[model samples]
Target: MKAIQAYRFALDLTPARERDVLAHAGAARVAHNWALARVKAVMQQRAAERTYGVPDEQLTPAVSWSLPGLRKAWNAAKAETTWNGGRLLVAGRRYPSSKTCSGCGAVKTKLALSERQSECEACGLVVDRDLNAARNLAALAAEFDTAGSGPVGGRGADRKTPLAGQAAAKRQHGTAFAGQTGTVPPQGGTTNRVPVQAY
Candidate 1:
């Protein structure tokens, strides 16, 4: 009822491309951990200063976990310099397509590394791998489509963060994402092109 539509971006990844994807993921993870550490450290420092009732400016700078900061960090990561994996466009925001599911709108749920295909038992959806996640992110992006939220993936704020931590089940990304697009991806995604897992 909320102007729901599918958002999908296709990435052309070869074995080399796959490596780049992994690299981008690694860079993102590093930035996240680094931001967290920085936040914790600054918080500690601020608490210590609080003993003397120091003012806000006197405290160490708090690490921002917003989306812009994350993009800046990722872009600056030397490891990911050559591996700029294309970002998935959801609603209008960018998100990690691999981690989320296309079937049930879950976030960061574990999909075995070996398990390229996503099968959503809860929704009875069967999906490929990449496309499935892409569609999931798309639906999530549209959750607040009317809110007119700006690009979500750019800043440290994940576009899908709003849907964080409620994955009781896994729905393949392509399970329904392909349907959103009008035509289903080839049965079993072609190696050259990532297939739509959910239908």
Candidate 2:
């Protein structure tokens, strides 16, 4: 007969270290959710095309679900730029960089793309549209560096996953009971028991 063993250990992480770990976890979740959403969107599109009597060959192309494929897709979608030395800074696509005035910190409600210049109504500062956007992005990069945070809040930050915090709150304590561990038995298999000390 063969035997299997498992071990668990807890780390004593400082506040900053814990925050960094949590940030990494959150980023992973975001990436996973983004990929999942992309897949689902493609599936829905294909289904709709089928309903419209579109031939399989004419339907939207399928997305690759493999790890490498997902990673490649994510890399293409994740618009990031190198800052300082090698640090990556990501600015949200929805940010009104071109419509925002670099001098007065004013955002125009409606700035036509044909307009090559951004004229600030609040401060009467006129600048090239691309130049204004560049300044705003630079300011955002500086702010991110100083705060040591992910993206800034406002129109630039993505929406949080629904009920994510609530789900985490419910699992504030360890899932397993003290001094015991639990595992879901495999199909047609007996429950395996293990004994261990709790922290």
Candidate 3:
């Protein structure tokens, strides 16, 4: 049981809410993929250099996934690109207990990636396209209404998910890992966990 802090934003999107949401989420995805690609390239290159005895001039500067830094990058890009209004923001403090089923809110821990779009079996509720996760985050933020909590575990892109082997492996390459499917939040990204059904 860890202390987590969350911030909830009312999308307050008009009829065009969905469109804007998607655009913004896509921006997040772009940022994540861009960051991931750059990081992976450099790490792999450096590893190879170490193995092959390459020189220092060829290596690139290390990129960080710190929230403030990433937010700066996002805001700068947002002025020039298309994006959503309310991007998801979870501080990732206490193992973010999001559930599926929207109705029952049963916190299943090991929800698989195949269950991307979820249907709440207990409450006959349905959620998809990452909205479910967003709703859950909203509820969580309300529940943990506080501030100034330190970063939780496994929220950072670099910290969460062992990417080195998964992407590099022939079979696992490109395979979506748990908690890495949808657009990641500024503090904590989307998770492959159950949605809080019904509510």
Candidate 4:
């Protein structure tokens, strides 16, 4: 199996280079805000039509809020915004990169947007806000590389089932709790297993 890897390096930018970087960052922010505004406008328009009892087919066409759609819209309007060309990279929305400790898998429950630097309690690593997040992203990418394109082991492998008419892989429900000292009652009229508690 092929293993993927990534490396990250911190840049030491000259004053002019730093200014250019800041300019591009500002442009990216402007583009993102513009795209969000456009998406909101379309959504509001659709909602207004619904209030007017417009037929579903006759309603204003819905627009996608996905990155590609936003990128296309931004590209068309960037000229009007008077921003010279700058590539906009969209990071994943879900990762709490800035709030996570790059040195350890520790997550902070709360972090304010105003905090520009963070000190990781777990590893005593103090880093700039953006650099810390960039490091975390690099770490995440490295982890994904190691996982590779293969059937994962443990819970994932256990959860999989053979196609219809194929022989059972082996009853795993009972096996999951086989090491427990106490006896578990049978569930759903099937093999005995520990009851799964719903959160």
Candidate 2 deviation (Cα RMSD): 25.1
TM-score of each: 0.25, 0.34, 0.30, 0.31
Candidate 3: regions farther than 4 A off: 1-98, 144-199
Q: Note the Cα lDDT for every prediction shown.
A: 0.57, 0.67, 0.54, 0.64
TM-score of 4: 0.31
| C-alpha root-mean-square deviation, candidate 1 | 28.4
Residue 191 error, candidate 1, Å:
68
Best by lDDT: 2
Ranking by lDDT: 2, 4, 1, 3
Arranged by TM-score, best first: 2, 4, 3, 1
Mind giving the per-residue lDDT tens digits that candidate 3 earns over 1-199? 9864432334343546545545555567445556767777878878887788767755544656556788988786664433322223445765434454445786555667667666666777777827877777666665664432344311232222323322333335345555556544453443434444331
Instruction: Write candidate 1's Cα lDDT for 138-193 as tens digits.
Output: 66656644434565433434333233322344556545343244545677553334
lDDT for each residue of candidate 4 in 1-199, tens digit (9 for 90 to 100): 9764422222444677556655655556446556777778888998999999998978766656556888888777755433422223345898899999878868888889888987888888888989989988877655654324343421133343333432355545654343445554565454533445442
68, model 4: CA deviation in Å? 8.7
Off by over 4 Å in 4: 1-69, 73-92, 146-199
RMSD of each: 28.4, 25.1, 32.4, 25.0
